[model samples]
Target chain A: MLYEKKEAWSVLLRLYHWAFALSIVCLVVTGLYVHEPWTSTQLEAVRTFPMAYMRYLHFLAGFVFTAALMVRLYLLIFGNRQEKFWNAAPITPSNIVNFFKTILFYLYIGKKDHRLGHNALAFTIYVVVFLLAVCQIITGFYLLYPESVFWQGWGLKLFGTQQQARFLHHIFMWCFMLFAMIHVYLVVWNENVAPEGMISSIFSGDKFVEKS
Target chain B: MSRNLHLSDLNPTLDRRSFLKACTMAAAALGLSSEMVPQIVEAAASPQRPPVVWLHFQECTGCTEALLRASHPDIGRLILDIISLDYHETVMAAAGRQAETCLHDTITKYDGKFVCVVEGAIPTKDGGIYCKIGGRTALSILKEVAPKAAAIIAIGTCATYGGIQAAAPNPTGAVGVNSIIHDKPIVNISGCPPNPINFLGTVLHFLTFKRLPETDSLGRPLFAYGRKIHDHCERRAHFDEGRFVEKFGDEGHKKGYCLYKVGCKGPETYANCPAVRFNDVGVWPVSVGHGCVGCTEPNFWDTMTPFYERLPSVAIPGDRGVVSSAESAGKTILGVAAAAIGVHAAVGIGRRLGKGSSCCAKPAASTQASDDKSKE
Candidate 1:
């Protein structure tokens, strides 16, 4: 019957969110174009730098994406209680139980589970997505500086060749795209049904919760 | 100094002037400057030619053919003047027992003082029975010769990686020289048939410096394999401009546009072919209108196949029969994910609407009961 407004995300956290999201969007778009250029200029080869420009954009966005991930990783360790990794993704027995409950809630078999931050299932997926981001960064750097002795010894040994690294990078790009789609849909769904202001919280850093 | 035998004396056709020019060209190709020419010339005429024993196995003799076509110094000058090629099956006048004798004599006479140049992949399956010479398996001969040599030179893709023979389902268990000889310093000059200048440069560097040139992790000389082919491509301007050849004989093809769209492997392949060219001619595969096949990379046959396509197919794990490009696989997975989400969302909305209609009166009754209790 009554609700109270509270800060769910810090200003810094919100900034990191949009930066990560926008950078990923730029990376994917430019990365796909670099992978397979779809446009060609009619101007002289010396007059245009279409492919070069695409590659430059992709690399620039990659650095931005990497920086955003670094910030999030720092926050995961040292941020507020709700933003701390263990608090959000704890694997305790009760957390495991609630993880399944969240699944059931998604399936419309149970009432919605209320939380101040990410639900158990969502947090687990975020952890996996973060791991993929790390992999993307490693492979991206390997592709960028293939002649580096460090990468030649370690990255080549891990992925076997530049082609394999490119493949993994491409695969991870799709994974991020998939995650973004599902994440947007779920946030919209929760905003409409759960009265948490889930969508607006990302922008305003506040959400309405039960008074208790 | 006693009148030492000069390089010109051994190869009369290569006069002193041409000999000096060849040396300079070689130094340039090896990423050395004019200052190294005198040292190279001295090494070339030193008369203490380092004996070389060339072995062939599971090969097409293309590397030797490429060597013969080197015109700067010529193969005759190379084998007779620069380095003493004691035993080469393709060029040696000896055969059968005589060839075997030459091989044995060189190994023993120049023991720990000669270079061993392996020209092909070694067959290790079934006791290396797939390839043999004089009834001796290539594996056994290599095991015997590699240990005695000062350094091993793996002089082709076959000897560096496994080449075409080591592609998927490698029936003969083909392996490179490095796979067998780990104790000795091995230099890999990798290519389908490596440029002869690279080989000559490596040998001359050894003769001049009394040691092998610096090599990449793959054992290829850094002078040749340090930068990607794409980095120094003649058609790089086209690549940057996004002007590409779409097909084999299109207008773009005739105009010499970038071959990136037609599956050029230069972007991923490391070599100096664009600069050095091949057969002493100013033309390589790309310069002549074909895309690079990435011949110098390890496992090129498997990793750089479908020569006219840009990217390798993504191998599906646990299912050898299914292979798909990365784009196709990504599109399929994204499609499935979209459909699943659509179904989930539709069912969720339908269930919520059904519950709202059926339970519309229950919440009103409970609110009224709570209000009455609060009044009491």
Candidate 2:
């Protein structure tokens, strides 16, 4: 069978994807440690700085993730037609049907077909993940400065109290964790089964599609 | 204007020097410097003592009891010298029609000049019939008395946020003083029974300045309720070191570890309890072993319940079945992800094996055809 090399992602999209992934990984790891802080303290002389450092890392990654998301949204609005905002909306009848069809294919009940970009179900999940990311950014910043006058001025009053904001941020972190798990597993599975090199396409911006 | 005539003989222990010393101490408690001590003394020693009308409603009268129990300056000094305690149900000597007469007399006599100290939650349901004093409902009495007062001081958790009465399924529909009286400046000295120093500071601040001190968003005076209990707690080092008491009577608990795990609301609660200590014993709740119940926060009885649990269980919106604690919810999501990964791995191996067998047969057939073509 012959194969044709097609551009699957743009350079900016690929860069944003990797940067977002890295920042999310950093945030999740640092955020979890900051929440519970289960680490044993053998370093008694410098015990306070670990939690402080974890907080710093978590906040830095949060800002990075927020900036990447803003850039990704900007690209979605003005980038190629495939990456446009309209593609994110899966409201049409065929898109709805294809969403279920993709689910059925994943459950091994239908024939699989290679698509150019994100399939219907993946696109919908990506949209949800994006919204969750926005929530995480808001809640994370709210907790970061809970004691500041500005937070009490109008910030937390709009969202919630500091504890409630923390709860929401924790929930969003878990959502991102679950999303990453499912997303990575499916991407690897798609690359192995369909052999479109989906995982590499995120990095190289190209996928080998079957030439009919 | 005359200092000798102004000194009260009823309380012999409160002489001129002691009164001035108490004023200095009270001023210092109000976050004022020593320079303001003379002003406080002048305010207290003045012949025109501010009349304070103390109101009792749906409460156990713990606030009045706590105030009377304050030892640093003595309640006699606070009531007789600093301010005229006019009408308190618990402490007033008069009774029945005489007491009712006194309340009305004070209301009419002061008429927007006196301070109104409310000590309980006000019930608004069933025409506010849950609590009645002098044949009038608490709500009716508050509506009658609040507007005519110069300033309103909600002096307990009950008066601040409806306390335990305003918890889940409140039958009386109880609410704090601010809910009913919105026009007046209400200084909320909030706690189960707030530190008497906070009360003293507020009253003295008003007595000296002729105005209330700056308050927080919740109307708690910033001088006393400025910082969270956790910020200055004795076990803060334990919290920073992650040394938490996992259970009651455990080694960590005995060793004075942080009570964060066993539902210490100190991190979320704002109060000066850790700084002042109840009854001047150098011990607060956490110092003794129990965690803070967050009684200072609004609606804490409902919001900060399951007192032994780390975090409250969140109710998911639009879904009645999935009430989950934060820990359980996180575990459930992670468990589902792990199970999904396992299932996906099994399916992937099965699919790969099925494809392997079919592709093996095709490759064998192709080799035979290629061999035939080469031999020809």
Candidate 3:
């Protein structure tokens, strides 16, 4: 009955994917370095080059992270949807059930179960990462408002002086570290349990399933 | 440059009878007791300007060099005019027996009346033989001079904490004048060849008030040593913004970013060099694209090191990529995470052993059992 069913990552989604990942990694590393004496301190352009350049790099990357967020939101709202259990998992109760089951499985509870759609564990990671990213964006904007007013201007006042904003930026960075460790563990665990859970979806936009 | 100190300058040197006669005349002139007039006139009309005996201990004589650079219209002349510079080893014209005689006479005559300005550190090891002036140990010389002085001013880092000589493995046990003279009230003006103005300020304050100015816990004058250099650094904006130069000539270096990343001890050091500046010049160390060496801090020689490296402290707020210390943020989040992990693990293990245990064990269990029937 199906006329045509093609599997592929749309350009906008891929743009969102890489940008989000890069931004998260950047935020985590910089945040950690600032807080603790991690590896002493790596020399940067600020060490050799003029100070303005390092600031530019940090500030400019902030906007890129914001743009990536915007695109992810767009994909959630406007991207084409296929009539498949996997892509449409968000709408199914099975998705919610699988999410918790995955959590229990990770904690080493019961027999492994097959899951389709956004699995239970995946949902939780998704939510936590999304929130932390939002925190980073808010804090980043607060620091950037002296230059960027669109979002950061009000954020600055809400956070108090630039020092308070700075203190928050350092504190909030740990979220990304926690998120990353958990993300890597769960993604690989998912890959092991359901070989094509994330890999197939991001690459081809479709996951293989046994027919009835 | 003049060497000789006159006995006539002090009318008190007049013979006992003449002094008593002068006292009677002065008392009548001033309406005071006859015997008290000479002493009163000496105290009121021309009190002896505090004699400043500049002593060079273990140092480069930088404090002496720096003092010569002072220019406040008439401050240098005022110093020369007011203080009887009986002896300054570096600049005084007297030498050999003449200089020795000068020091002896000043101590013998002025004794408790003159002020002593000791520059550089005093070595205490090896019977204090590491440094000597005129074949006498610096220690013995200092011990001899310190007791008689009314007040003592120890100028420059060399005298504050032995400068770099006391950095590590201090063979000589080089120490400040205070470390050697525990009884005298020592006023320290600490700096690596400290700003001339700080020294002048202390000296003027002493002259005007006839008493030492307020000092901090370390016996440093409060006016200059009260504030941190970082608090007033011109590049403070760069530090607050998390803008820093990583290397010797990177792009940020060209833009003159903060040197905090490059071992700026500004945070830990307390001094006003950044505010008052040096040499009347418009720039300081950090302003010149270098980090503060914290030259003013106590034992900055040993405590602050890797001169071009960041201090092992601080995650400044207001910086774009700043992250706070984990002690507050990391500890709280980590605690939650650890608790969450523990609870989750316990729930999973309990579920494996029992009927229900977890965030949603019972619901997941019923559903999984239902699914098993469907698969069959």
Best candidate per lDDT, number?
1
Write one digit per residue (lDDT tens) for candidate 1, span A1-212.
Answer: 79987666755467668878998999999899888887754531432456566666676567667667776786676444456687658487767777888899889888877877778899999999999999897888788766569866767876769998899889989999999999999988877778788888888877788887
True contacts kept of each: 0.03, 0.00, 0.00
The reply for model 3, stretches above 4 Å from the true place, is A1-212, B1-48, B70-78, B318-376
- Model 1 per-residue lDDT tens digits across residues B1-376: 1122354346456567666766777799898989889999999878888899999998899898888745444533655577888999998899989899999999999999999999999999999999999999999999999999999999999999989999999999999999999999999999999998898888889989989989999999999898888878999766654467889999889989888778899888999999988877678999999999999999999988889997544211211111112223434544543454355345434544754644564453343323322322
**Candidate 2 chain B: worst 10 consecutive residues by lDDT?**
B315-324
Q: What's candidate 3's DockQ score?
A: 0.03
Give the alpha carbon lDDT tens digit for every residue of A1-212 in model 2: 99987776665567668768998999999889988877636532321356555655666566668667865776566443345556535787767777888888899888664576678889889999999888886777567555458755554765678878888889889999999999999998787668887888887777788899
Better of 2 and 3 by lDDT: 2
Worst 10 residues of 2 chain A by lDDT: A40-49
Against the unseen true structure, what C-alpha lDDT does each candidate score?
Answer: 0.79, 0.76, 0.64
TM-score of chain A by itself in each prediction: 0.95, 0.91, 0.71
**Which candidate do you rate higher for lDDT, 1 or 2?**
1
Could you give the CAPRI-style class of model 2?
incorrect
Q: Is candidate 2 or candidate 3 better by TM-score?
A: 2
lDDT of 3 by residue, B160-271 (tens): 7788778788888998887878887888889888876676666655664567778899888877888777777888776766667888799878889888887889888778
TM-scores for every candidate against the unseen true structure: 0.54, 0.53, 0.52
